[model samples]
Target: MRIHTLDLRFQGIPGLIASYLVESGGEFALIETGPGSTLAALRSAIRAVDVDESAIKKVFVTHIHLDHAGAAGWWAQQGATVYCHPNAARHLIDSSKLIDSARLIYAEKMDSLWGDMLPAPAERLIVLQDNEGVPLGEVEINAWDTPGHARHHHAFVLGDVCFTGDVAGMRLEHSSYLSVTASPPQFDPVAYVQSVDRLMAAKFKTLYLTHFGAVSDVAAHLANYRQRITEVYERVAAGFREGISTEENRRRYAAAEHQAAMQAGVSEELWLKGESANVTSMCADGVRLYCEKQP
Candidate 1:
């Protein structure tokens, strides 16, 4: 199987988001659809490679985040099969709750941040069970229940590569620094760490992340990712103990992370882009929600 990454140019940033196109024996599958805002770019990219966008028979996403599977409905409208976790199948097929949830996060900027998300036809939706395998040409794509970034999240193990959505955290192409993506309502730090450990225990040659590109150093990247997620939660937890507002906690968390990135020698350019892709404001809500759920 040959895998190619297409830059969605999210929020006008080239490497902030990516969608993978996998082909085997003339059959093609699109892993992540990015957001509806980049549906046109995705089509143009596929066409530039001489493959018709409509020829993608199987469309799979690691999760239902706008940055991951936001454009699945658009592809389904084009005659493609949309596959996602059963927990999220209804949301994607209807998308009324999806849009409503986005309103909570993006507010008036929802449309600007992530264009329209039309419902995927109900007949085209396929729900994936954990550990179930679906044929992707010559390879069998296996799904793992990875519920850290979201309860409905799944990581696909295809041949030698693992298409880990937010379960593996964020890292852009230009730099090697790993950032957390603790988005609102469903972020679980304990589960996030365990999921990273699970990915490490699984035998995979490389990890293809939705936030950006692929990472060959699987062990090193995941170890650092687990440690960082813990640290970010501890930092946020301290703010909660102090009785600080969520907004104030987010401010402190972002500043601390920015300083740590500077000390670690991450470039200013990618740091800015990476943060925009997964900001502390969202992470703050995620941490707070998890903290409240804890004893």
Candidate 2:
């Protein structure tokens, strides 16, 4: 199986988001369609490899998040089967709720940020359960329920390579800084840790993150991600306990993340760009919600 990492050049920033094209025995499958705004970029990337967008008959998404599967409906509309976790299937079949929630957060910047989210046809939306495998030509793509960043998240596996969606967090290439992508409404720290444990137990040789690209250091990456999730969650919980406001917590988290990136040899410009791509404020909001729900 050959995996091609397609850089969507989201917001004209390289390494911010990626979509994967898997080729096996002349058959093609797509993982992560990025946002609708980058549809043209994705098409260009695919054509760069001499493969037509219509040749992709299968589309797998790690989750229903805009950056991951925003253009999935477009693929399905082109006659490709859209596969996702059962929890995420309904949302894709009817994206009204998802779009409304995102609109509330992004408001007027919605179109530029994520573009339009179209609902995938119900008949074309294939829901995969945990441990189920979908045949993609010679290789089979397996789906594992790896909820953490979102309740509907899944980590797709092919042989020893795992396409870890946001459940594995965000880590840019050449930078040792790994930030926990805790977004609101469904970011459960405990569940996230458990999902990491699940991934660790699988012992995959390589991990392909949708945020960026491949990670060959699977063991070290997962371990560090698990530890970071714990550290950030505890810090947010402590801040809430100390009566810190959500905005203050976000400021503190962003500052700490910037320092970590700097210590890891990331340039200030790149760090700022990454911060803009994956806003740390959402991380604070996610952790705060998790803390509030605790007994």
Candidate 3:
């Protein structure tokens, strides 16, 4: 089995998002279809590798987040079976509700940021329950119900490697700084931490992050990510406890993130790319909302 990491070059920025193409027994299975805005890039990447679109018979998404599975329907239209968590299946079949909710968050930039989300045929959309496995030629892709990044999130395991969507957080290649991508409406720090623990217990030899690329040091990477999640959640939680306004909290969070990135020796260019990919404001809002619901 071979896994190819296809960089989507989101917003023309490399390392911001990726899609993994797994090959086994001459058949291809794709994991993650970066937002529709980068559909052209994905096609180009596939062609560059000399694989036809029809060769990709199965498409597995970690979640239905625009950045992760926005272009899934496009692949389904090409005759691929789209696999996702049960909670995310209906949304992919009829993306109106999904688009509406995303518009509320992205507002005017929605079109340029994510592009149009084409809905897959209901028959083409296959919902995978927790612990279900899908056969792809000689290999089996196992799905684990790994939530916290979003309730609809799943981490797929292929042998010893795990494809962790957003549940594992965002880590730019070569950067030691790992940022939490706790987006709004479903970000639960408690569940997020638990999901991280679950991944840790599984002890995968490598992790394929949808945000960027592969991580070989699974244990350390996950340990660091788990710590970063708590740090971020506490930072936002503290701000709410102190009665700080959401905007102020966002500013402080962004500033702290900048400082941390600099301290970690992340280049200004890479830091900016990471910031654009996972906005600190959204992270702050997610944590703040989680805190608000607490007694």
lDDT of each: 0.86, 0.90, 0.91
Q: TM-score-based ranking, best first?
A: 2, 3, 1
lDDT computed for candidate 1: 0.86
The residue-level lDDT of candidate 3 at 129 comes to 91
Off-target runs (Cα >4 Å) in candidate 1 are none
Task: For residues 1-295, write the lDDT of model 3, one tens digit per residue.
Answer: 9899999999889988999999998889999999999999999999999999878889999999899999999999988999999999889989998899989988999999999799999889889898899988799999999888899999999888999999888897768999899878799888999999999998999999988799988899999999998999888888898999989999999999999989999888888889889998998888888899999
Candidate 2 runs further than 4 Å off: none
lDDT of 3 at 49: 93
> Model 2, range 239-275, lDDT digits (tens) per residue?
9999998789999988888888889888888887787
Give the C-alpha miss distance for residue 95 in model 2, angstroms: 0.9
Each candidate's number of clashing pairs is 0, 0, 0
* Distance from true location, Cα of 268 in model 1, Å: 2.7
lDDT winner, 1 or 3: 3
lDDT of 3: 0.91
Mark the regions of model 3 whose C-alpha exceeds 4 Å error after superposition.
none
lDDT (tens digit, per residue) of candidate 1 on 1-295: 8899988888777888888999987789999898888888888888888888768988998888888888889888888898889898887888888889888878988887888787899998889898898887788888889998999999988877899988988886635577888988898888888888889898679999888789998888898899999999998888888899977988888888888777778878767877789987778878988887788
